[model samples]
Target chain A: MGGSFTVNHLIYLLQGMMWTVVLSALAFALGGVAGFGVMLMRTARTRLLRQISFVYVQLIQGTPLLIVLFVVYFGLGVVGIELPPLLAAGVSLMVYSSAFLGEIWRGCVEAVPRTQWEASECLALTRWQTLVDVILPQAARIATPPTVGFLVQVMKSTSLASVVGFVELTRAAQVVNNSLFTPFLVFGIAGVLYFALCYPLSRWSRSLERKLNVGRRQAA
Target chain B: MKYNFDFASLQEYWPEFLRGALMTLEMTVIACVFGLVIGVLCAIGRRGKRKWLATLCGAYVEIVRNTPYLIQIFFIFFGLASAGLKLPIFAAAVLTMVFNVGAYTAEIVRAGMDTIHPGQIEAAEALGLSTPQIYWDVILRPSLERVYPSLSGQFVLMMLSSSVTSQISAEELTGVANSVQSESFRSFETFIVVAVLYFGMAMMLKFAFHLFGQAIFPRRRRLGTPL
Candidate 1:
């Protein structure tokens, strides 16, 4: 009865796909907030803050996301706080994404010409005011392309969450494949679904990068 | 409210851990060497005059870039098994990393290649250099030199991603950590040790690449900066 691929399996996979999107959105949102703080700390005036965040980023970036997932999942359990799979996966993804996104945004912020920062200072602007009025607007434009690009990475990486018992797209594929015994057909369909989700974002990121380059040239 | 950590019981597994780390490093080195070769060829194919070859390379890049590597590994490992042509887990893992890193390296190499001035190629042609000679001397060397930093970074990421091969139980560092943790019931401690090992490995690789860069790119070493 379970040997054939069926519409029921497709429907289940579609449902799992929805969870994948939700997890990606959740991770991105949470990581964005934390990563902004990290970016600020890394670029902050205080040497201590900068050093702390620098080490944090290096440590997180060095380790595999899979290990991070296991650490979050089982570490919490060790502390007698058992979380559901989704929460554990989300927390780990947030940690992973924050390190990467923070680094990306730091680059974007630093790309704002040094002259602009000095000019803002010369105008007697406070650091916050300078960041808000003079620096962030410029950095935001540079950040958009990479941020969108990183979203594709995030979406694809959510597949790793399947390992921690989260029934996302990849996990769902595994489940179906277990029943149907068709690795090629099942995983191929899963891969196609992921491509459908990610391809547009990749194209958009490329186009944005091209447009940004063109805009810089025209300005020059 | 309180949990005591015990690493004493895990000390006996040090040899296994060391072996696993060695295996991980071995896989990364093999994949990086082969992947770079494949990547350079694909990058060349992408820019060649043949439409079909370019398109084929383009599709390979896009498909690999867009899909998750986990599924790619599963497709190869399990799909082959289902076909009754089962490969060893180590071979399958290395093949998957090569395929995944190859696409990424092709892109990076292509970007480097794009920055080579068209006039430089024309100059080489004017000097009566053959296509292979021009490619080797005027195109590939400088392009690789320019992209060395990115290539090294990708290779390190490839090393870390190799942890996923543990899913197929390839007995890499992460796989060893998984089993050791389960055996000792000390999951947190085991992962902490493994995480530190990974960090150490990543830093060592970065240092090694920096030194290798100095050795190869004498021009950059003289300037004291990357291109």
Candidate 2:
């Protein structure tokens, strides 16, 4: 049966791992930008904008990412916009992560005290100026750990692309196991590689949470 | 670019959809109960005096938390089957969910336990409660009550994420969608309708957990507030 898993299979899995990282970076970058806009809309002055953003978040968050992938991958095909597996996965992951990241960053922004905004306004700064120059900087500090933490979620999520025929680590393992009938070895290696990729990010997130002494605001 | 959506044809598949939805709910219910039991035990183990027990529980949490559910399912369904510990497909999928959710619940429960003030424990100690009694009355009860909101939310999330169990060909909502799409060749309509069904089921799970929470936590009913 094609002799057991060989060095070539390991190499292929490594290649798949590379693509997993690429897709994760792509999703996080695109999602982060879109998430910023969502955060702004969520924390906007107008109640309508905040409500609209809330609904968008709820809709995306409520649906499983698998359904999101299916809708993006196949639903767009119905409209004559066919996307390749990588692009489809990338787009869907971006949609999923943007909702989560937006909610996370919104919490960070809301964590900033009301006095800072008022103080900035008293200093004659416009609302946009205060947001850009004052508020966001503070929120960015609090957002670091969770943002890095969500990166692990982004990486694990890239595995779903395999369902759409994108040969990431999980898909590579599946192909190898199909031929060699050694699901344990193949999938075990893939799981360990994912753990290696995610574990450090998780540790960093935890350490950041410890380091960010929020006592200044915790008491507030 | 003229695509027609024949959801009307799906009228005949209504039974399939309902069956699929109910199956998903069943798995979620089973997973939630077993997972929380495992989670609570692990949480207590991590905080207990046994050195190796805490380490083993810690390792379990880290491994499950770090790995993706997709791989975890593949490992259990196929990997363990290859190792001759074969299980039914539904059992394998739900087992994987219990394992995965148990780790997450352990973390959340641990956090909730940490939030209990030391003063509260001292007060309980002064009342002469034994160790087991202290754990049940002073520690686990209040920590669980404190984290009920997040715990219930996690169960709701487990319902949504359980869609992955369809990979093992479990007759859950997503698996039903797969078969229906193949039969109807109305892939777009099939997926869109199934997605809406999933969203609806997610809401249903959340609401059900909410009501269940209200019923179980009597203090909440009396105080009209979280513990």
Which candidate should be chosen as best, given DockQ against the real structure?
1
- In candidate 1 the C-alpha lDDT for residue B180 amounts to 92
Candidate 2 chain B, run of 10 with poorest lDDT = B218-227
Candidate number achieving the greatest TM-score relative to the actual structure: 1
Clashing pairs in 1: none
Candidate 1 lDDT by residue in tens digits, B81-135? 9999889889999999999999999999999899888999999999999999999
Please provide, for model 1 over A1-220, each residue's C-alpha lDDT reduced to its tens digit, 9 standing for 90 to 100.
2678989999999998999999999999999999999999988999999999999999999999999999899889989999999999999999999999999999999999999999999999999999999999999999999999999999999999999999999999999999988999999999999999999999999999999999999999
Query: Candidate 2 on B97-146: residue-level lDDT in tens?
Result: 99999999999899888877788889889988898998898889888888
Give candidate 1's error at residue A21 in angstroms. 0.6
Write down the C-alpha DockQ for each prediction: 0.88, 0.80
**Error at B207, model 2, angstroms:** 1.7
* TM-score to true structure, per model: 0.98, 0.96
Docking level for model 1: high
**What's the TM-score, to 2 decimals, of chain B in model 2?**
0.94
Off by over 4 Å in 1: B221-227
**Residue A105, model 2, lDDT:** 100
